[model samples]
Target: MKANLIRLGVDIGGTFTDVVLEKNGSSFSTKVLTTYAAPENAIIQGMHQVCAKAEIEPGAIDQIIHGTTLATNALIERRGAKTALITTEGFRDVIEMRTESRFEQYDLNLNLPEPLLPRQMRFTVKGRVDANGNVLVEIDKSEVETVVDQIAEAGFESVAVGLIHSYLNPAHEQLVRDVLAKKLPDVNVSISSEVSPQMREYERFNTVVANAYIKPLMASYLGRLEDRLCEEGVRCRIFLMHSGGGIISIQNAADFPVRLVESGPAGGAVFAAHIAARHKLDKVLSFDMGGTTAKICLIKNQTPKTSRVFEVARTYRFKKGSGMPISIPVIDMVEIGAGGGSLAYVDTMRQIRVGPESAGSEPGPACYGRGGERPGVTDADLVLGKLDPKNFAGGSITLHGEKSKSALMAHVGQALEMDPVEAAFGVAEVVDENMANAARVHAVENGEDLSEYSMIAFGGAAPLHAGRLCEKLGIERLLVPPGAGVGSAIGFLRAPFSFEANRSVYMKLSDFDSQKVKTLLCDLKREAAGFVRTCDEFSEILSEFKVYMRYSGQGWEIPVELTEEQAMNPDAVAFQVRFEDDYTKLFGRPVAGMDVEITVWSVNATTPSEKVEPVAATDGADTLVVNGARQLYDPATAKFVDAQVVPRDEMEEGQRTAGPAVITEEETTIIVPASRNAIRQPDGCIDVVTKE
Candidate 1:
């Protein structure tokens, strides 16, 4: 790595675009409202602002790393290109007919999420590939040409080819793509074997469809962004943050745009993991709240948990199987539309409910004075005196307290028959409880105890509510690191160039093929390494291996990590022992009579991570020096209190202040409740702990 290299990291959230410029070991950041029509406009705006703050020209920057929620938003809003899916004849409805499991088993009126492409848009051809990669029926060129002609007639911009058992054999899908390309050369194509290349036809098919769905949009956006940046005199390499918590070349990103889903939240998870490493915390709960969403991730041993498959735009909040599952490597987390812009309203039961819906940047929260009529969390925060009208977002956008009050009164107060302040309290309480409940559910699902973890809060809105969330979750320690407002953007700078490759080739313990396993792992390693090489050929690369294993009759598999030696010299007995150990830890015991089987194998290749030196724990000395005092709402007391307000940069290391205080910064504010005390750690992190 080059020392003192200037790099720019930009993250586009639902409501805000965060930009961080790191040059000469110093960091400068800025946040701007996201431009929905032209997302790159916001990036360029933020980039120029941060570049000015860093006292450097855009041309001086060495590299640009970006992450965005555009792909995810496009899927949720159904705003992508007119895409079609071409699959095996009999499996045309596989994506619609999901697995047998129901997210809400007892609800008679449960609504399953609709498939991305409608039935009319999905076309099929006559071809068959068996589970073992054997071709039962060769793909017919005439059939593929006919399907291509139909797709062209339908005006499809992109097509997804997902043949039955394509993960095992790609010949049939490749033939279809070849014919499609020959017949309709302008349309984009995505094949399941190349996109996912894993078992489970539904997930693989959906993954390819998603990739094709967003391919044209993302490709155009990236092209425009590059052109815009070049016009702004930025001449450097551009990389994209991927869902797997790594950086990939922009070309790679455009090709497999589905990998970029959840990229922004993945960066936040990476940020929390970095902080965890710095603090030497073994267990951490990462809480990131921005304008449009909140993400909760569990970090163990300084590494965020990863998943091979994660759902997007979940229709049923907190329900696992109620969303479209995209089988891609991703940083695991629970995301909810519970952010500053999350609209608050009263349900039929007269109970206040916070989002899944947000008044995004165009017409943001009522307090933003952006023509939003509905009451949102930001409006509530403003009404509750938790936000400074003149200081929010460095005063780039002024907030209107009166508007917030009126919105709250009209939306929530009237229904609940309460004053605006009381209604604001209700909105705030409901949103906070929603986040707390999400955190609890996530922790429980991971078999983790929240009490054993420290909370690392970031994003534009996390600090404002993290203390209250911590109090609710019974978490003792909270760390609000510097540049918390642009944490995800900064995280993009810290991410390594990496990629993960996975394939499914089943092997039972009784008939284990050591040579085949070795060959598979080697191939995966090479594939992953090839991707990393595109990003940085000179950087030393490292490989990590894992296998998804299960008992003979079980459907799902648990991931078991493996060493290079263990993977190369596969021993059935050793593999079973390791699987048993992990299964026992997860379920308390493993079945003794069942034989173990390996289903999917994975390899991750990456450049070296940035080294983080641990910060020594300090006993902060109490020194009450208040810069000012503000009338802040105390949730604990259910009333307003005169709380000391201090600028974050003004406090020295080891300085401590009691709760009922607000620590202000240019980007965000940290609210310390009356029951907790805030201290300045040596690393400039605001460490808040419960008062003894």
Candidate 2:
């Protein structure tokens, strides 16, 4: 919140660790290979590199805001600590018996994903809390103790306790935690009431289990990161980026690591929103393609769309209802396994299929010369001349073009009976089409048209492919902002301190009690504000209210936002009006003569967003800046074209360049497709637009 203070933003992705150091209003950044054995090692390496670039020591950093994909990775890889779950006696299989929804409805061989915890690992307690917070059956302390003893005998490092209806009456769940604390004090415990106080036993139980599964791993990493920073003479307070596009205290993040599952992509969304606000664009598509995954989100009114629940580790082609559902406040986006390091090979249909499998930094893309045999998206980019073999990562790492050619030939070309160049083209097009299709589907799901939206592309690999993606999606304008390669890390510095608290208390409008509604909202506000206060005690906090409402007999609900006055002054008529307005927008029209019901209430408390200086639009003189030329593969034409190569720093404000050009920066490169032109906007953003 103070000017001239040095701050550090670190994001650890599956393949790369990005660090940005901001000092005296200027920033320096660097990317390093992620160390899986010791993730913090990468952070330290990246931090030092940025510090050296800024001509400062690590000790000069006043604060650090970090986000990571480790938690999501743990859940995906199922390499977390050995964890057990305790639940109501009858609901032991809630997680395994997921709601009746099939991602693949007609595929009889649809292989359902295995639950996080096996039935043997999930022990049940004899306790019952009714829907109205009434105790139908008091929890037996002895039964919980017996379960705890079994858990200890089974050598579980962590425990999850999720009693039915615990969101209404957490007293039963607390007793189990108290018993665990007295017996297995070292074993970490996660309870549904504290982790996610929402309805639906399946999502609630799964969430707590996920939190418990990764709690120890995250806590250990955070502890080691703090110690390593302290060992380096850095005394700055540390914070963590959360999935809801906000910053939280490190302690809270460690306590509830599930909230950090989408943290990195969340930061990117925030960054895109910030850019959208500065450019005065209400409808923008956020495209973030990193080393391991690509995330696409839609921003309206400079705010990233938010969701209360999202799936993680979708086992069946990134389909809905195919992965473990995580119930937390998150930036809603569609993330697919398409990134620079995503591997490619010919499928059974003789089509190239790119990742959900990435050759991470250990043995990165084939072009990295890191012992990887399979060609990846990066390898394709290298073979296609989108990357410089000599100057990759600003010459920090040399790329081997021959290796890329060989891998592409062996993996894809040979199978498809094509040359290496054609194979590379196939791989690139497949990956780009995958991303484009994902963006289109996401937009359609939200009732939006891609043609009406501008694109904000970021992340390490996005700019290189964004132009072609724009072409495919029929998007007219694209903005590749400054520090685009490390946009998420930069976003950490721009986010506000905030937290969202959610509770599910089903109440039909016919039975709505205004006094009770006010009380419920107030309590949630306090709970969310308390978490934000732990991050920053001095900043003035603001509150946002939302409720999920649906007509009676509907399977799902739509989120309806409410102002402070409308929220505080509970009116059933007003609530119905708002709900119908949002429903009509989402669906074609609202059903008439149906009673509306509120399912979940959410309150987000956040500090004010940082003020931004707007950037004036720039129109360059009708001249091109052609510093040099190189052979670039044009995807639109499916052939090689001589393209201009211009260094980013040399492009002055309002300057322009024609299609088939490479606007190169130290961290990344922007490829202007044959159908587009590039403009250096006044704010250092390369604005790419359609030539027509």
Candidate 3:
């Protein structure tokens, strides 16, 4: 008999490698410092530890799902392969021209992010397809051979082909790809029609170029990971999380690597959604703070809000329009560099500024004793008495407090003429405020109010600073779920095997074609379902439809939900009614008599969500005793206070602990601030509520 079937989830973060093992009804997890050279080494080590504790062999694992920050890191570090872009002749300037909007309007020395491929690397071919899906200029086959020779001589590892209006007519793009394969079989190629089938030349070109830039890197890493896993006696299918909050097969992920840019953060959002569903919560703000960056995602009614386009590597201090736009389905969220390992420094303005630069796993933080001299947010937390130097990561790695103090005092303390402790508090507070402000801006931009949403804090550092952030945002309640350290990994297990299929099919509601729309929707359903079938063998599949619509002459589109029956029988009146309803809900009102047109259509097919019923309340202690007390700086009091420390496992269900407490777990710590109350929930979560 099989020893015991288990499902494993692994997340490789910038600071730590987290693994969660689910066998039968129980779960076990382990956290280890991430190895930068080979992230898979940390995963294998953590897996071995967790399985050993559970007394199971590696072969007993039935499935292993993984999420990683590698793709995002490659984009941020500019470590991807040398890439070339082939676009329509005149459209080579589109990526640099952008939308003619400035992210920073007043700065005279504003520096936009440099395009991934320079003008010389961005070549154009003799081909033109009009917006109406008509061939304006036939692609010159002879010209293609010359372009191929130039690209080959340029030593580009990959190439992106994006012709004018290729989303409407992909014939020329396909022919170019075929010729390139014939000329250079080893060169990775991506086309806009296949990578991002949408309007807007800049976004489509950026997406395809980004895909090409990362193709070689992702392909090599994925192949090595698969081989290593099989060598470790794990014979199971591997799936990767997509930015759309779904799991796709490795093949698909490799082909469209841009979709994997936000894949890890998307998993964290899914994990928070699952926890919200378990507690019957309708609105939640998922906060994930890892080592390299912090992300905030909003979930309402058990679904994370999805966006069709997102940016990568924001250059102007995380401002919109300062980054490359990639058209893909992704969970909408705001990501900033305020994570534990985010470096801090005093800028030219003599003001403290936290990162967009991080030490990552290689040097990590000064406290980790990894030869990092610059202070990080983690070292500051230690100096502020927020973290137990000896108890971090369940004592797997002991932090050097003196080193942390030295780094802080040498870098920030001396400049401000303040002691290390005060500087630490200042750093912590500033970073906390930065994250809170980002959360507020993101929510307001999406027309949401923080007071109406509960906060779900996860990741290694999120639980540490969540209470303070909640207070700053005026958020009343926060939930710290179990397995919070590897929340994204747990989310990978929760994600369903699904795929989103999108195509550019322009249609005006005023002159809608019901039969044509019906046929298109049917074809999309089959396309999406076929992709999902490759990952899951289940006989049942469910699908959802969406249409990207905009007013006539508008250059952008917003997503509108469509039911299966509605897609099959798209009546103009009914379509307008649904469109206006959604429009009014978002923008308060719709322009009457304005013609609406659908620019793109999308379909998502997936397995059903898993059922996780709420746990019933049980008789338990009302108050829990503390293990010890420590001096914690209370910002409200402007002084240090004696805070109680309690081990999370020792707290019984329904146990209540007042504010000024530190609940420690093996993976992370939960800090309940002075103005809040913490309660132990039935399902091993710490619920924090504001004081009346």
Off by over 4 Å in 1: none
**Collision pairs in model 1:** none
Q: Number of the top candidate by lDDT?
A: 2
Model 3 residue 573 lDDT? 83
- Cα lDDT computed for each candidate against the true fold: 0.92, 0.93, 0.88
What local lDDT does model 1 show for residue 531?
A: 96
Q: lDDT: which is higher, 2 or 3?
A: 2
Across 239-282, the per-residue lDDT of candidate 3 in tens digits comes to 88889998888888888888888888999999999999998889
By TM-score, the candidates rank as 2, 1, 3
Query: Each candidate: RMSD to true structure?
Result: 1.0, 0.9, 1.9
Please give the distance, in angstroms, between residue 150's alpha carbon in candidate 2 and its true position after superposition. 1.4
Q: How far off is model 1, as Cα RMSD?
A: 1.0
Residue-level lDDT tens digits of model 1 in 463-573? 999999999999999999999999999999999999999999988999998889889999999999999999997999999999999999998999999888898788888
lDDT of 2 by residue, 1-692 (tens): 66687999999999999999988878899988899999999999999899999999899889999999999999999999999999998998889889968899999998889999999999888979899999998888998898899888999999999999999999999999999999999999999999999998899999999999999999999999999999999989999999999999999999999999999999999999999999999999999999999999999999999999999999999999999999999999999999999999888999889999999897999889878988999999998989877877778999999999999999999998999999999999999999999999999999999999999999989999999999899999999999999999999999999999999999999999999999999999999999998888788999999999988998888899999998999999999999989888888798988999999999999999989889998866655657699999987678899999989889888888988899888788999998988898999999999885
Clashes of each: 0, 0, 0
TM-score, model 3 to reference = 0.97
